[model samples]
Target: MIPFFRKIRQKLLSRNKVTRYLVYALGEILLVVIGILIALQVNNWNEGRKQEKISDQTLQSLEEEINEARSNLEKIISFNERILELSNRFLAGELTKDSLENDPTQIFYLTTYAFTTLNFAITEQELSTERTILGRQSLNAKLRISLQDYLSMGDLEELLGNFWNNEVLPYFIEKKMMVVYNRFLKQESINKEDIQQIVNEEKFVNLVATTNSMNYQFLNLLKQLDKDLEEALVLIKEEEHD
Candidate 1:
């Protein structure tokens, strides 16, 4: 193709067809420019496709993570509700010290009440890739932007960590809840009056309140995350089919 164009130019120059030569030269330049533009467009299209594929994969991974988050949130909510029940019962004298003394349900909630953070490890490297994908999504529909907001919040995980580290575990230590817990664990005979006295204390009540609050917070985030996951899955499914 190059040689053919060169031969044509040579012919025009030899004939002193200056106007024709200039026109041909201009036409050649225009063709070259058009070719370059076309190549750039193709390259851009390819890059976008690559990023979209990465984003799709990331969304799928997020769905899995969201499922885990939802599961954790559900467990937390149930446990918190149980604690709330226990608290209410103790205060109302419905759950006597005798009942509290033998309550495995209450013991489990207190012992394993730490935050279980969701693993976003899949997105560690894919966030930059997802920004474009997220930006292009519908925010109102809990699409990409909503997912972005959910991811950015990280509140559920942080809430659990804060309570466990700053309040939950510390309260147990500072308020001697742990001592009561240890006594329970040691299979020692707990005086029914002492158990009643312990549950009715200000510290134990406060812990119950905090636990309920923490669980509620976790549930709220998880609900949103669950919605976001459904929205994301719909978007991804449509994209995949398209």
Candidate 2:
């Protein structure tokens, strides 16, 4: 193509029709400019398609992450409910202190602690990654907002971790230690009345209060997480439709 244009220019220049030659040269230059513009436009269109594909893939990944988060939240919620039920049983004297100390109920609370710890660790990493991806300013605006809200729910979950460690664990540990000490120190001839009185003391009452507060906080957090998860599912469905 370059050789063809060169030959045409040479023939035109060799002719004495300078005005016609100049007009032809201008026309050739215009054609070249138009061709370059068309090529650029095509390249831009291809790049746009690639970007959209990337955005779609990112949204899909977010959907999977949100689903995983929902599952984790549900498990946590179930665990919290069990904890509350156990607390109720203890408070109502449905399960004697001796029974609580010797039976699997104590093990249940310990297992809950372990699970909560593990879940918090794993969720923190997932939440951090979600935040990083959401922070990417190059992402689509709707996706960014949806991810931000999802991450906010994660932040709420992280807040619950503090309640677990500081408030909940201390309360359970004190109760467990009292039961263990009483059982071991006064074996066979356990003073049930005296033990109940001790557990009903003002300090113990405060500890129970703290435990209840923590449970309430956890319940509230779970509700918020459920709402966010539902919203995220809706967002994913809309994206799929789009």
Candidate 3:
């Protein structure tokens, strides 16, 4: 191709058709520029197709993660409801202390179980990969922003960790203390004064109330999580349309 263009140029110069030669040269330059532009355009389109495939894969993975999260959340919510039911029965005196002490249901109400059950583990790498793919400036702008906001605000791992440590753990410790004082110590026929002394130590009353409140708050948070997950699914579906 190069030799062919050279031969044409030599013929044009030898003819002394300067005006026609200049026009030919300019036409050749334009063709070259157009070829380059076409090549660039094709390359860009291919790159975009590859990126879209990657984004779709990422979205699929995220959907799987979201499903897992939703399932886990449902389990947690169910468990919390059970705990609340048992606690209410105990509080209402419909369930005797002895019956409560012996009930297998009591085990389900334990904060330790809640901690273990609700502690949904997620790897930072998964989130980072999702964010990187979604962060591309080439992505649909609204979709990119939606993904960013979800990544920033709707972190399952962080929410689970905070709920377990800040809310669940302390609540469990307080409940254990209460069980030891109100049930075990009382069973042992410990002096009322001594039991009172134990209850008075280290903000025991405050802890018991806080523990109860934690269960309530956990339920509330679970509701919020369910809403967030539903919203995320909807957003992803919208992105698919675009």
Candidate 4:
């Protein structure tokens, strides 16, 4: 192509058609400029396709992740409910000493019912790598808002972690409370008689109530997150059809 253009330029210049040569030169420059622009636009288009593919894969992974989180949350919710039920039963004088002794390890389990919310591991990684995720044109307003809210829950998860460590854990693992079964420390679990005696305390009954409250809050938080997860999937489907 370059050689053909040069040949035409040589012919024009040799014929002393300087005015026509100048016009030819201007046209040649325009063609070159147009070609460069076309090439650049194609490159940009390819890059955009790559990004959209990445974004789609990210969203799919996120859907799976949120679903997993919701499933886990459901299990946790059930667990918390069971804990709350048992505690309420004990408080209401429905649990006999014989019944308590029947499940002696209930003391260990109930007292140590500490839980942590699942972190958005892959979602966070994707967001960190792609700062423009929320602003992405491929992501609709609804999905973006849900994602933003869900990401912000990291702070809430962290807050819960701190609370569990500071208050909940210490409350349960008090040396006088549970001589927990520890292989590392070679500590033996308390006898059934000891567990029965421990559960007989007013503080133990009150602690059960406190745990019920904490578990309720945890369940509520999970329910809200589950809503976000469902919203996110709905938005994903909407965007796909659009």
- Weakest 10 consecutive residues, lDDT, candidate 2? 110-119
Q: Give the range where candidate 1 is weakest over 10 consecutive residues by summed lDDT.
A: 107-116
The most accurate candidate by lDDT is: 4
Per-residue CA lDDT of candidate 3, range 115-164, in tens?
32332223234344544355533333433443443353345435545655
Q: After superposition, how far is residue 26 of candidate 3 from its true place, in Å?
A: 0.8
Report backbone clashes per prediction.
Answer: 0, 0, 0, 0
**lDDT rank, highest first?**
4, 1, 2, 3
Q: For every model shown, what is its TM-score relative to the native structure?
A: 0.67, 0.63, 0.64, 0.72
lDDT of 4 by residue, 1-242 (tens): 99999999999999999999999999999998999999999999998888777777777777788788778867876776777677667768887677865555665445344364665777667656664255554444444555665555555556556655676567556634435434213544445666555577776666666656565565566567677777767766664555
Which residue pairs in model 1 clash with each other?
none
lDDT of 4 at 155: 51
Best by TM-score: 4
Flag regions of model 2 displaced more than 4 Å: 85-198
Between candidates 1 and 4, which one is better according to lDDT? 4
User: Of 1 and 4, which scores higher on TM-score?
Assistant: 4
